[model samples]
Target: MKPKTPRISAVDLFCGVGGLTHGLVRSGVDVRAGIDLDPSCRYPYEANNSAVFVERDVNEVTPAEIKSYVGGRKGYSLLAGCAPCQPFSTYSQSGRSKKRGLDWQLVSKFGELVSQVQPDLVTMENVPQLQDHEVFEQFLGNLHGYSVSASVVECIKIGVPQSRKRLVVIASKLGALEIEAVGKKGNSVRTVRQEIADLPPIAAGEKHADDPLHAASSLSEVNMKRIRASKPGGTWRDWDPELLAACHRKTTGATYPSVYGRMEWDAPAPTITTQCFGYGNGRFGHPEQDRAISLREAAMLQTFPRDYKFLADDETVTFSRLGRLIGNAVPVRLGEVIGEILVEHVRKAEKGTLRPISEELSGRLF
Candidate 1:
């Protein structure tokens, strides 16, 4: 009989609520553990994934600690980091990031860990804006012996129901590795109508009898009037002068028209943000409902399983905390795509059939 193939193992860094870990498991990789600093994430990450949740800052995590998670039995070792993107996000360009004390060197720390651990495979996902920074180039410099492929990927093209653009980088010591192309030709883009159209409808401030996450935030009397007059896919520009906010009346605020709008039923949702639960935050209002999209709908748009657990039996469900967790999660489908590519890369390497990316292009960021 042919010998059994050795198992593939992985450790997820900055794994918020196990979005990436769950998707990697779904694609057949054994993710041993997920590490994040937020204690609130512990219940959801461990409850939803087979992996253990480690609450520690990534800067303090040593190579030995990462290896200990998987023990002695592993054919391939993957170190995956979807570092918090707020530091490199386009939203930060307005100078508010300075006040948040955001750590810009975390990506460099991730690279330093990779150099120390020297895992067989490494993958990273972040906002597309990260691709332009010198830190990303320095991260690439750390992988001295790996063939690397990096690109900006559209989440909807990979079956995610939101219009999120993320930078994905794959590196391998075994041989060349490229993210597998998916959602071509016959595969239709996932739409908002397909994801949340069937849910039991609830009005503003109402929670479903059985599901707490289905609750919507309460709208004020004036905001209720504004929403009632809002049309799907239409911005605050479509509203009457009486319904417009004082800020919207100013020349500066006129540029920010995407807010106070409703999502279209037939199209994919705009990128989910931490403030997505608030109707005034973005075009987050429900297509037909007279309220903003519920927490459950946001998670579904992020490609999480409809029944995925986010809290324990005794935990209280708060919109602010849950919204941040759900919004910050890596879309699960994109994680699955990375897993598929990694699995195939290993398979080809074992057969000595893996192709190497050209040296000229390997160092270039797409």
Candidate 2:
């Protein structure tokens, strides 16, 4: 009889709302657990993914604890971390020197754990700006024993219905590493209309009675008037001068035209930020509706499944809390691509026909 293929298992650090876990599972990796500092994540992370949620800060995680969670599994073990990227984000760059502190240190901690535990595989995703930081360089330097490949991926090219950019790194102690791209532009790019056009519409400041999470934040009277005048792909520049905010009236703010704009139905959405439910944040206004995208719509754009449960039936949907969880999640489709990359690498290694790192790293392997 032929021997069985050994299972690959993973532990997700800073796993917000189980986005990475969900995608990895869909790609056939057994995600054993998730670790995060937020107590709020426990419910959705565990409920949706069927994985244990350890409510602890990544800085406080010990290598021994990680080993125990893997339960002495004999196959490849994976460690994935999507460290908070706000410290390295473009919005924070202007004040980074003053704000640089513990969060920046977390990446170094991830490096330290990898050096100590030497998991079979390690993967991470963060803002593309992180590639330019010294900390990222140090993390790459620390992976001397592994084959590593890192790239700035356009999320839209990976089946996500948003034009978000992220830096994805895949490292393996086993063999050569490569992450294949997913959706291709012009041919397979998903659009806002494709993802959420079928959902029942709700008016500004209203919730869908059937799906509580499909609720939009209440808009102020002035903001309702502002959205009424807004056009898809159009900016506040098109609005009546009287409706423009005092900030937009200034030359400096005029340069920020994407704010308070509506997303085009056929195009991908702007990046979903932690405050996406507010009409004033980014191009969050609905293409046709007079309110910002609902919490469910924002999650779907992040590549979460349409029926993914985030809250209990009795719980009131809190826009601020859910927005942070959805905005901060690693897009599930991106995670699935990462999983497929690792799985293919493992299969090639087992066959004793692994490709050379230099050749594989030169071009798009996907």
Candidate 3:
């Protein structure tokens, strides 16, 4: 008989649009429930990930509930948590942050749950800046006996189409664990053309019936005029003298030229952010196309599948809502890489014999 398929189950905390959940499922892990307080996520989380969305706060969640949701058994029960990182994100320090609240305590809340549930595996992904946080240091210290591993790895090296770095950690009660990150090959990262080059042409705010999520958000009048003048890989500086934004003319705004720009057809995209649907956000404009990258393109740059559904049939395509979902997701591709490492960790867990790399993965390194 074919060797029994690996039995792994996962519970996703702060799961936005089920990107990671969907990836784990595709990799043969049985993803149970995607826990998040956002009720809006119910549609896409369940629609694409095939996992139930538990619309409850992660901090408020109890170990009994986690055990039940993960289906307590001999199989590996993976707890994946990506607490809201706006507080620790570089963007928070880059400018004045408009976001704050109890949600910032969630990373610690996750550590508390990990102490209680002691799942077979643990995974957390967030912006690379989080590695510098005192809370991150304390969280890693809390894993006393378990084999743990974490790194501030780049997403591009792992096949993500965008240039994004994330802090990924994996821990296990089993023995030691290790996950080797894919090294970046000569700067030729996957390009914008490789991602969505062949799709039929689409205008701003247009939707393609062939792909449910292949729709771009509409541009405002000013942005429309700007895009008309912009070239692929070109910046807002390319705009005609009359079309410059008042902010761009300001001395401070001149420092960031990547804003309000178009991606190059042969180049990788800038990081996809919550505002990626907006023409003025980052370099989200489609290469050769006169519009900001669509919700679908954003998701694709984040390494979600081409046909991944972002909404249920009854759900309306609201830019604010869908953009938030796609922007906030733990790129499924990242999760799959984590899953493969965790699966290997579990396989060696019984003997408590962690691969050397696993040991290196267990220690902390900035």
Candidate 4:
């Protein structure tokens, strides 16, 4: 008889648009359900993956509810959480005021759930800066008996077509756990051209007749002129001095050269943000088009499948809403990395081939 398939059931906390769920499912994990507070995510999270979408805050969810999602599952239980990362993101840190209040507490709450649920395995992905915060220490403290391994993963090195870095953590109650490595054996980093060049071009403010999310946001005449002069991988400095924004004329604004820039076709795209749909946001302008990258292109940079559905048949495509959803999502490709590791971690544990927890955490970060 063929060897039995490894049994792994997962419940995703703060699942945005099912990025993590889709990745996990793609890697052969049985993702049971996704929990999030956003009603807008309900359609996509459930539609793309074979998982129920629980429309509720992570804080409101009890261990019992999470257990029910994994009820009667056989081999291993996994709890995945990618809490709202804004609080720990570098952008939020560089702003005038520090991001705090309820969002900060959410990390604590994620720790609390891990302590309460005590699943066989746990995974979390977040901004790299989070590892520096005290909350991260508290989160580690909650894992009394688990061996944990965390590293700052370079997205491009992991087969993602974007220049992004994220903190990925895996903890297991059984023996030692390690994320299976990839992308080191002549695996070339994917590029913007590789991911989105095939997409039919659309003008600024125009939506594709066939794909609603392919629409680009409209630009003001001044912004249009600026984009027309912008070159791939070039910044607003490429424009005539007369075309410069009032702020760009100042020394402080000169330091923010990434704004109003165009992405290079051969390189990985800049980190996608909530305002990526706007021409003025980051280096979001298309390589040669006089328009910002559309909602669909932004999603593709985040490693969302081309056909990934973000809206229902009757729903209208709103730029701000969809941009927030797409930008805030954890890259689906990274999620697959997380899933592949956990599956192998389980397989090794069952065969008694894993190391002890004490030996594994010595050099965890990569």
Best by lDDT: 4
Error of 4 at 229 (Å): 0.4
Residues 80-183, model 4: lDDT tens digits = 97988776666555542455657768888988988998999999999888899898999888888999888898888878888899998888988876544433
Name the regions of candidate 1 deviating beyond 4 angstroms: 1-6, 92-102, 178-186, 356-366
| Ten contiguous residues minimizing lDDT sum, candidate 2 | 178-187
Listed per candidate, the RMSD to the true structure in angstroms reads 2.7, 2.7, 3.1, 2.0
Q: Which wins on lDDT, candidate 2 or candidate 3?
A: 2
Top candidate (TM-score): 4
- Residue 208 in model 1: lDDT: 87
Q: How many residue pairs of model 1 clash at the backbone?
A: 0
Model 3, CA-based lDDT: 0.78
Per-residue lDDT of model 3, residues 1-366, tens digit only: 643546888898898788888777766788888899988888778777667889998878999999997755757888887888877654445432555345447888888888888887788887777777788887787676667767887777767788888888877777655443233122246888898887778899898887757788888888888988888888888878899988899999988898888888887788888888888878888887888888888888888887777777776678888888888888887787777666655666555566543345435422
Considering only N, C-alpha and C atoms within 3 Å, which residue pairs clash in candidate 4? none
Candidate 3 segments exceeding 4 Å error: 1-4, 90-101, 179-188, 350-366
Local distance difference test, each candidate: 0.85, 0.85, 0.78, 0.87
- Candidate 2: give its CA RMSD in angstroms: 2.7
Q: What is the lDDT of residue 359 in candidate 4?
A: 77
Q: Note the residue pairs that clash in candidate 2.
A: none
Task: State every prediction's TM-score relative to the real structure.
Answer: 0.93, 0.93, 0.90, 0.95
